[model samples]
Target chain A: MVENRPVLNVITHLVLILGIVIVALPIWITFVASTHDAVRMTQAPIPMLPGGHFWENFTQTLLGSGLSGTETAPVWRMLLNSLAMALMIALGKIAISLISAFAIVYFKFPFRMMFFWLIFVTLMLPVEVRILPTFEVVADLGMLNSYWGLSIPLIASATATFMFRQVFLTIPDEMLESARIDGAGPLRFFWDILIPLSRTNIAALFVILFIYGWNQYLWPLLITTDTDMTTIVMSIKQMLEAAEQSPQWNIIMMTALLAMLPPVFVVVAMQKLFVQGLTETDK
Target chain B: MLKRVHFPRSVLPYLLVAPQILITLVFFIWPASQAVYQSFLIEDAFGLSTEFVWFENFELLVDDELYLQSFGRTIFFSAAVALLSMSAALVLAGFADRVVRGATTYRTLMIWPYAVAPVLAGALWVFMFNPTLGIFPFLLDMVGIDWNHYLNGTHAMMLVIFAAAWKQIAYNFLFYLAAMQSIPRSLIEAAAIDGAGPVRRFIDHIFPLISPTTFFLLVINAVYAFFDTFGIIHAVTQGGPANSTTILVYKVFNDGFVGLDLGGSAAQSVILMVLVIAMTVVQFRYIERKVEY
Candidate 1:
């Protein structure tokens, strides 16, 4: 196959190289800028070589952002808070979507389509669209600045629900029927049959939800008024904003890079599931 | 009340849907109602409080220069990105559907940007557009056209739209490509044998087959553009260069969070919610059914 079509293969490689360049250029620049010193960074064309200012820039940023603890921005604590918030969201959304999907697909109950459509509607009314009112609701609920504020409202992801429902619809009907014939209830059948059969899907949804939760900024930023309660992305955002006033390219870039590590790690680790998940088409 | 009790089977679905229902109610429905209610009240656009002066917030928003600019820019940015990205994705996905080898690798790299957070994508672009040492400026300088997003409104919004679209076009490509691959190859083979050239074959056969995914993405991307693109706008332009890049969500952000004009923000948010609901309902009722298999 490789030897059969040299011209076609070359065109493919050429286009792909173009794509790779387009994708990598900005990211590559970020890495380069993160290594340069503050003074040399302002110079013409800037320095591409890794400089000695990484530690100085990172430390100053850490201390300057008051992230060095002491009644100020607790970086580690906030990271933990962000992690906990993201994880809970991922977990809550996954558990709900899986069970809801299993129920909707397998059960012969009434209004299944209604329930399905209700879930689908959220796909349209995404959290951001209703963010203002949602914030007011959170405030009214007495959940503002609490962990629940950071988690609940945005965590019930309709996209995940719809995706899981789509996948659940794909589980062979005979598989469900046969399992039911063996006297398995919905829970038993779901736990014993559907879930095991949907390992690729579960892995896929896990990564998808994890990414979604991790990348959440607006809701978290809106609800958490205190600087001490910031997510990593919001923290980087504040740094980037401040860097605008007092230019610290290295620190901003480094913080941005660090902010990206967890999701990039998620992407790299679950690249397989992601490919399969995105590439899987339903009839 | 103990007259007739439902079985566990009947009650289970409600049980499953309760949390989502409650959360969606509290977050989406109730707040939306508040926003709608609030939008009717009169208030200063920059202030935090409001009185029951009827049908005025929307009227005020209609007349406000910055608000109008944000609205127009939102529509333009959303429509342009959706059209450009969807078409590009379709063409690329069509070509990608053919190659049996390295398809996984292609898919992997293609969807990579979708995973990059919008905030990060925006920040990355901001870095790339840095006036002094940014790649874009450096490239433009190489071409003899000095470019700076910070100094130009058009450049600012253009970069903002492109940043939002870049993260998504590949995602649309992946989904559409998967859909195209599902089209029986025999159909295309038959089209080929029927005296159709590659272009003709794709135009007549493969194109219609993937219309459904294209249509699905059209609405999804429209909703995404209309509602979810604040991170890019905020992080990259911050509605700067004289408010050229300020979209609706960014406006909502600024109004509520930054300016503390909570009622006004809620009003804008409500208007946005109504627009989304109407669009989505139209999609589900009409456009969705147009999708082929």
Candidate 2:
């Protein structure tokens, strides 16, 4: 607002428009490809505009045995698997992190710092680094091909716990004293006071974690050997691999769209919480 | 730091922290230790024999030409991705900050790609550039350029870099835009009053002021380019076209899972762990310094 030259303003708009186009071009193409039939998609210089087969591809990808002859599970089944895993990861991370953060901040217990550093160390050990051994551990524990395999190993989040700790630290001491004066026990106080107070933090973290859990590729790829256990996100690779034989770009792109829709919807619908969670957790 | 008015010492704290600690131990700690242990031991392909060969695996990795090439390639890839995405984000953020209206709308349009998984990002880009049937290849045909990432190493690397950088733009843009908006308006206005143009004002005042954010983002983007782009490479190239796009993380996964080189892969994992730990420490230190700012 300080100095708005007309030329500069026009350039600014142009540049931003260009940026948006570059960013959205792939999704647009994916959409366009999804709406076309397999015959149209295999043609060169595929249609820039969407085709009329949107519902056909959507139903086939969602309900039918996706990419017939491929060993991958149906799209709806994979979506359900993804939903179950995502919910378990997001909720499980929030639940464990809230209690652990509660214990670390609100109770003077033995080995508290030890436990804190232990959790902190997990930040360095991303699942990508220890992929094989972690797979072995999950397999050894008989957790493979199950929702627990998909979620539990990934749910021990250092960022969420740290975020909750930061939120609890900013809370005034008077709240705890008042709760104590009201004769509320620790569990009661946590359930009534801390939980309610950190509500927005939890929601914000949930927004971020839901996307994270849903988008996970490597972990689920390793453990989910059973086709029924395949998540939609991981199933894209299967479809892509299967495309070597079928070249079913319509169903493949549709599966890709379905895999990404929920997480993308969460981000767009909960943009505020998404931004808050992202910035706060990284900090 | 504990609260000033914490509850009395009791077993409740243990009860509360048990779940996190147990998961951390069983999954994180145990598996990580196993990786470290397996790194030092040589295991045959058939799992019929495991011989303790301390330092041999690390020695082999140090001497291995392919490992060295992968390491150098990873550095190149991360640096390229970080530079491309960060500069793009900085430009868009710089312009977006100038927007007096509909900034949120601009932001919304810019940031939804952050939700797209890396693999899906790869899929989308791969489709757009599918050599035989892609839009880009078709367009390039008129200009006498044959684009086949499947056959060309350089094309494959470029395709992966583009996809990875594309996915990262939303993240860097968000952070850069936040950093820019947080700068005091008066500084820019004062510079404007001093006869500096917008570009000049940004170069002199705004850019230097956001250096800390820039530094923080460099580390963030480096870590991201290192780890988060695995799915992208896996889905797009699978580190193919003669290993042109095989970053370190991909190499680890391929060697371990696909090739079944247990010892070598475990050693690679250990090296990656060290890299992540080093990066995490640097990041935390930057955060501490950022707090002082």
Candidate 3:
């Protein structure tokens, strides 16, 4: 049997190897391209290998934007802002999803179904399509050009609420009944019982929210006009427009690949957890 | 089971729901209404100065040949991208599901493309398709076909479809693989024991079980393709090569931002909302019935 299977296994491995090459090549090329100077990248059959100008390019990119270079992109500052903004988004989503899910599932009340349906209905409204009018709300609330403007609206996603609720619905009633018999009050039982059991679900939500927040483009790009408080995506977008002609493809590619790292790492490191978390959705 | 509920718990539900309500209203409901309101007005050909003319924008949008053509093109593009991406993902994910060696690595590599920013992905393909240095042009030259996206409408449209497909294939793959992994292995084995060949077992057993997930993803992906792809289009071609790539969302953005005609953009947006809402209603009325859970 082992001898007979060698050819099939070889084909499988070959296909997988090809898959990895295709998946990693664009990004791998981008990473190397970032290290080289811009002038070198324009050459034909561009270098297939990494160059030695990484530090030089990195330093120049950081300083390249600012008043000195036609409205310089504060890449580092935006990195910090992006981290802060994405963190807020992640934290806000988790807290809200957990709380809302608990309320709708564990504690029943009037209009419960109404509210649940309402939250779920929110999923259908594509934010990109509705963004123009929402700008007016941002203006009306005086939330424009601030972290509040960037973070507030995103926290309202019905998707996470829907996700957490689905996770909650799967647990057997026996656990809750047993906890109640043990004299564990609501908060104590939820903290000790529910939260511990749902760690995987929470982690999945974290990965999902973090990536969504990190990759946000149009809204942040449109809303935040201030250079000091722009998200990484906004900064990247500005860099794209500013450097459209003869773009330092290396630096831009580097930033793009770097931006993608955290999410990719989240998926890789938590592969087992994320898979379980995703698979658990139907429950 | 009907014991008296505590007061704190009674108010707790509202507290939990408050943030969602506030954010949704401000970001979604309010702005959506505003978009509808602005759709009724008119702006001059110059576009900067706005004047209030009731239903003129909407009326004009109804009679506009350019809008009609672009709208039809948008529908065709959305349907094509969604179906192609979904089918591709299902096949790849199904293949990955059975492959034991390096399965995790393969999954990770495949899904990483989803994380690439839209602009970056768009730009990456531009490099690939550019005639002076693009790999595709190199490909076309060997085949004795002149393929230039920068100047050719057909080539540019193909490039847009491929780029858009690349962005979504990763996401759909993740969902399908996740769905397949959830199916109990015992059933698959049992089906195999009954003499279901690989292809037969897949069609009869696996596809049905995965249909719910497939259906759910269909609705979600359909919405994404219909409304969220303007960025990819905007970044790649700006609806170039004789406006063949211009879709509805791109037109909305172009009119609102570039042309400085807010009224016209809003009118187009209103029509956009109607189409989306109608599609959503149909999805729920007919397609959603197939969702198992």
**Which is the leading candidate under DockQ?**
2
Put down candidate 3 lDDT per residue, A20-50, tens digits, no spaces.
5766666776777788888887665567788
C-alpha local distance difference test of each model: 0.73, 0.94, 0.72
Deviation in angstroms for B280 in model 2?
0.2
Candidate 1 chain A: worst-modelled 10 consecutive residues by lDDT: A66-75
Candidate 1 is scored at a TM of: 0.85
Q: How high is each candidate's TM-score? A: 0.85, 0.99, 0.86
Q: In model 1, which residue pairs have backbone atoms overlapping below 3 Å?
A: none
Candidate 3 wrong stretches, greater than 4 Å: A1-6, A62-70, A108-110, A171-193, A242-244, A276-283, B1-9, B43-56, B142-147, B179-214, B278-293
Worst 10 residues of 3 chain B by lDDT: B1-10
Residues B1-293 of candidate 2 have per-residue lDDT tens digits of 79999899899999999999999999999999999999999977688999999999999999999999999999999999999999999999999999999999999999999999999999999999998889999999899999999999999998999999999999999999999889888878988999999989889988899999899999998999899999999999989988998999999999999999999999999999999999999999988888322
Fnat measured on candidate 1: 0.43
Candidates ranked by TM-score? 2, 3, 1
Over B1-293, each residue of candidate 1 has an lDDT whose tens digit, in order, gives: 10021113567777777788777777766776777776777666555566896766777778888888888888999998898778767766765665677877776666667767788888988877777777678878988978888898988987887788877776788778777877877787787667776668778887878777777788778887876677888788888888888888888878877886765776787778788878777666654465545
- Superposed Cα deviation of residue A249, candidate 1 (Å): 1.7
lDDT of 3 by residue, B69-182 (tens): 898888888777788888878877877777776787788778777666666666667766667655567667889988788689888888777777777888788888877877
Interface RMSD, all candidates in order, equals 5.7, 0.7, 3.9
How accurate locally is residue B148 in candidate 3, as Cα lDDT from 0 to 100? 83
> Candidate 1 DockQ category?
acceptable
